[model samples]
Target: MSSSDIFIGETIGTAILILLGGGVCAAVTLKASKARGAGWLAIALGWGFAVMTAVYISAPLSGAHLNPAVTVGLAIKDGDWSNVPVYFAGEFLGAMIGAALVWVAYYGQFRAHLTDEDVVGDLSARAADTKAVEAREKGAGPVLGVFSTGPEIRNPAQNLATEIVGTFVLIIAVLTQGLNDAGNGLGVLGGLITALVVVSIGLSLGGPTGYAINPARDLGPRIVHALLPLPNKGGSDWTYAWVPVVGPLIGGALAAGVYNLAFA
Candidate 1:
């Protein structure tokens, strides 16, 4: 496929991923219904499906680096600079469009079921009063956001440690199995490895805060959450937003640092 075709495929594939991934989050959270949260498994499985599908679709053409982190890691490891800019821009824009489509797909139901009060209640930030008023005009609420924070994390140090540990595991996995040495990987075997990691974290370490290991995955959706006006929207919860970004970034870097020290 041509570069143009690859770009188009990247955009479409990314959109479908977010549409399904974030859509499931909203299906239950935004509007109350019998099927609320029915899609938790769907959300998780859909993300894996999205990654696999996006790669399958774009691999022959452009290698399908659909994630910024993956792209960054690849550049760091292999020094492939030719298509970096194009792939980076494509992945970012694709995420935006993907999220926007999720916003559009669920627009009507938002208006029908949501009310002003519900939007007000969902704000993650304390400066919710002003934000809620703003969201009303835009027809949005708290946002298409996901965050991870340690429960009972009143002390800053322990919380930081938890984030570091989780991210360390994730980055190490990404490096060893994903971008570092693609040859010896478990191949299809790696898929279940990650699924197990997520489940284990959710069951054990995830109690305090959900695992917001990917910065783009959390903040990108949160930005959309703020902009896409829906009923009963809440605050952006800017306070805790950094946990995912900082934690994962640090974790990834630490994992890389450790890997280099041991193996390099």
Candidate 2:
């Protein structure tokens, strides 16, 4: 594939991936949405479907490496780093676009959810407590979860470890079983299988740190959340942002090492 094809395909595919993935979070979390309170199972299934759809849509052009971790792992596995920067650029740009679209699509819900009297009151109450204040400094705000992941408990070491392990599993699966015969994109069946693996990771390993196995997935939306003018939306929790980005890259590299040593 040409560089233009790689960039365009990845941009479109990653946008769609984040649009649907973040859409589910908005639907389940926002107060006025019909799917409010649908719970975690719904999110896992939604993301799985999102991955399947994005992979099939973009695989032909750019190999459907929507996640940065996937791109990094493939680069390491093939010992080719030529197209890595292009993929990263497309993934992050597409992710930001997708997140902005989600906000537009759910504008009314976001307004209602953020400006609700009860929610505002709760935030104010929490602000007064010293510990809660500290947590807010290092953790996400009320609506951040709709755009990005956060931890149930605020232990950096454990959170980092969880993200690393989750991403390791995802990249290893892609290296072993998710690639097409062309060795660039996912095959017809590989897309479905990869989607199932995503669901499995979400269900089994998503409890802590919300399983941010993709660096672009977390950071791009988080940046959007920080920039968008949502009323009463608190801090972006910049302090915790590094964990997701660094952990996934580490996990992808480690998975590539294992693949080279054992599978290659």
Candidate 3:
């Protein structure tokens, strides 16, 4: 693929990936939506489908490396760093666009959910409670989960470890089983198989930190969440942001090392 092809492919692919993946979260979490309370299974399956759809759509152009971690892993595996920055730029830009689109698509539900006294809890009362204020600043608020991942229990080490482990599993599978014969992108059936692997990872390892497993997937939307003008949207949890980005990069690099040692 040419530079333009790689950039365009990744941008469009990551946008669709986040649009559908985050759309599922918005559907299940927001009030006044028919799919509200559809539960985690819905989210996992939705993301799997998102991956499959984006892969097929972008594979021919840019090999559909929609996640920064996947880009890094492939770079390390192939010992080619020439295109990493372009991939990263496209992934992040696409993620932000996708997240903004989700906000637009679910604007009413977001307003309804965020403004509900039952959900956000009397803002004055929450303000009076210092702990609540602190928690909201340092952790995720009610609707941040729609755009980003956060740990149920706030332990940085544990959270980072979970992301690393989940991403390790994902990258290893992509390297070993998801790539096409040319080693550029997913094969005809690889997208489906990789999507299933994502679902399995979500079902099994997603309990903690929501299995980010992809740096661009988490950070880009988190940035959008911070920048957007959503009502009563709380802090972006800047304190925990590094865990998802750093953990997935580490995991991808580790998977590359293992693949080079055992599978090369």
Candidate 4:
């Protein structure tokens, strides 16, 4: 195929990825009056499904990288430096575009709920659990917003720990496949590892701040959250935001570290 096709495929794949990936997040988080506090398990599974599906569809085309972190990781590991720029550009553009689309798709959900600046859904939803569910059934009604972090714990130390650990698991799995023989089943097998990693993180680690293991995953959607309409939304909680970013970066570095140590 032509270089143009590869670039375009990468862009389209990443866009749909964030939409379905980040989109599920907004669906569960936003007070859509349909399903509230659906829990981080739902979000993580949605993410896992999104990753595999994008891989299935785009793997043969542009490799369905979906995240810049992954592209850089691959480039670092495999030495396919020529394609890195193309994939990175595609992934970045797609994330921005996906953020915009997500805001649009969940527009109704954002608009229907009360916007209390002090409303932190995690605490308020539990207190209003009964009301949250009642509103969901009504459709376009009020639903309790159970605010939680991805990687789930609230404490910065704990949050960073989860991010670092979650991402470490993810990068290691991918590199395991990279280390295998060229024609091995690692291509498909890698997806299963990723699925398990995400599921495990959600079921176990997701109780706190919700594991925003992927930077663009959190940042992209958070950007949309800022743009969208919602009542009484709390601060983006920027103070603890760096954990996910840094933890994942550390995790990626750790993986690179491990990979490098092996050769050394």
Candidate 5:
């Protein structure tokens, strides 16, 4: 694929991926939404479907490597780094755009959920009763799971390790799977299979850091969460931001190393 194709395809694919993926979070988390409280299974399936949709749409043009970890793993496997930057540019840009669209689509729900009397009251009383607001913000606005992932327990060591292991599994699967024949994209059925892998990861490994596995998937939307004008939106938690970014890169590189040593 040419640089332009890679950019365009990744941009569009990642946008769709985040749109559907984030939309699921919004749907399940927002109070006013019909699907609110749908639980984690919905999220896992939603993200799986998101990957499938994005991959199918962008595979022809850019191999649909919506996750930066996937791109880096492939580059390491192939020993070509020229297109990595292009893929990164597209994935991040697309993630931001997709997050913005999710906001637009769920504007009413966001406003209702964030501005609810119980929630606003907690925000006002946070200095005195932090736990009171924690209930409201568990999955609601300000610190939404839709846009990005967070750890159940705030252990940096464990969080980083969780992301690395999760991403290694992902990249390793991509490298070994038959869908990766082209070296640039997955085969016709690869999208569906990869989506299943994502769901499995979420079900099995997602509890601890929400299974970011993809740097662009986490960081880009986190950036939007920080910049977007959402009422009562809490801190973007910038301190933990580097964990997802760095962990995924390390996992991708490690996966590539393993692939080179064992399979290549």
Candidate 6:
């Protein structure tokens, strides 16, 4: 495919990916949504389905490398860096657009969720099982998890390691199983296989840092989180932001190295 096709395809595919993926997070996190309190299995499966859908839509145009980690892994494997910037541009832009669309889709829920002073500020008033409410600046922010990942435990080294390992598995799967005959994009069944792989990683490794195996997936939505004007929305947690991006890139590079040595 041409560069224009690659850019447009990635932008649209990634937008669709984040729209549904983040939409699930919003559905589970927002107060007025019916899916609120749906557990992690819902999230993992939702994201896997999102990947499947997006890849099927964009695989012909840009190989549907919606995640930067996947794109980087492919680039490294092929020893080609010329189109990396274009891929990054489309992926990040699509992620932000998708996050914004999620906000639009759940605007009422967000207003209700964020404006609840008792929910935002009063831990005593919250339900015993309320996992979505988090206090910051003495009030709650829109749940960051809907837009980006955060660690269950705030250990930086461990958090980084978790992202690295999760992304390594993801990149390895893309390299080994999710390639077309031309080896540029996913095969006809690659999307489904990759989606299942994503589900597996999320089920097994998502606990630590929410399995942010993609840099653009985390950073773009983080940028959206910082920019959006939601009342009582807490800080964007920028201190931990680099872990998702850096760890996945490192993991992608590592996966590519392993593929070259063992599989290529």
Q: Rate the local accuracy (lDDT) of all candidates.
A: 0.55, 0.92, 0.91, 0.61, 0.88, 0.89
Give the alpha carbon lDDT tens digit for every residue of 194-239 in model 1: 4455445545565455555555556666676667665455455665
Q: Between which residue pairs do clashes occur in model 2?
A: none
Q: Write model 3 residue lDDT over 169-226, tens digit each, in one string.
A: 9898999986887797788788999899999999999988898898889999999999
Candidate number with greatest TM-score:
3
C-alpha RMSD values across all candidates: 5.4, 2.1, 1.4, 7.4, 2.9, 4.2
- Candidate 4 has what TM-score? 0.73
Per-residue lDDT over 163-223 for candidate 2, one digit per residue giving the tens place of the 0 to 100 score: 9999999999989986787786688888999999999999999998888899999999999
Q: What's the best-to-worst order under TM-score?
A: 3, 2, 6, 5, 4, 1
The C-alpha TM-scores of every prediction are: 0.68, 0.94, 0.96, 0.73, 0.92, 0.93
Look at candidate 3 and tell me the lDDT of residue 87.
90
Instruction: Supply candidate 3's per-residue lDDT for 7.
Output: 92
The per-candidate count of clashes, in order, stands at: 20, 0, 0, 20, 1, 2
Error of 4 at 131 (Å): 28
Per-residue lDDT, model 6, residue 257, is 94
How many pairs in model 3 have backbone atoms within 3 A of each other, for residues 3 or more apart or on separate chains, i.e. clashes? Answer: 0
| Candidate 5 lDDT over residue span 1-264, tens digit each | 799999999999999999999999999988889998899999999999999999999998998899899999989899898999999999999999999999999998888877886756655556467665655444334545779988889999999999999999888988878455667768777888889999999999999999999999999999898788888786677778888999999999999999999998
For model 1 the TM-score comes to: 0.68
Least accurate 10 contiguous residues by lDDT in model 3: 132-141
Q: In angstroms, how far off is 230's CA in candidate 5?
A: 0.7
lDDT of 4 by residue, 20-106 (tens): 766776677666546567776777798778777766666566755666556556666665667767776676566657766866777
Candidate 6 per-residue lDDT over residues 1-264, each given as its tens digit = 788998999999999999999999999888989999999999999999999999999988998999888888999899888888889999999999999999999999988998787557664555343453443632224578899998889899999999999999999999999599878779888999999999999999998889989898899998898899887677688888899999999999999999999998
C-alpha lDDT of residue 56 in model 5: 91
The positional error of residue 170 in candidate 4, measured at the CA in angstroms, is: 0.5
lDDT-better candidate, 1 vs 6 = 6
For candidate 5, what is the lDDT?
Answer: 0.88
Q: Candidate 5, which ten residues in sequence have the lowest lDDT sum? A: 134-143
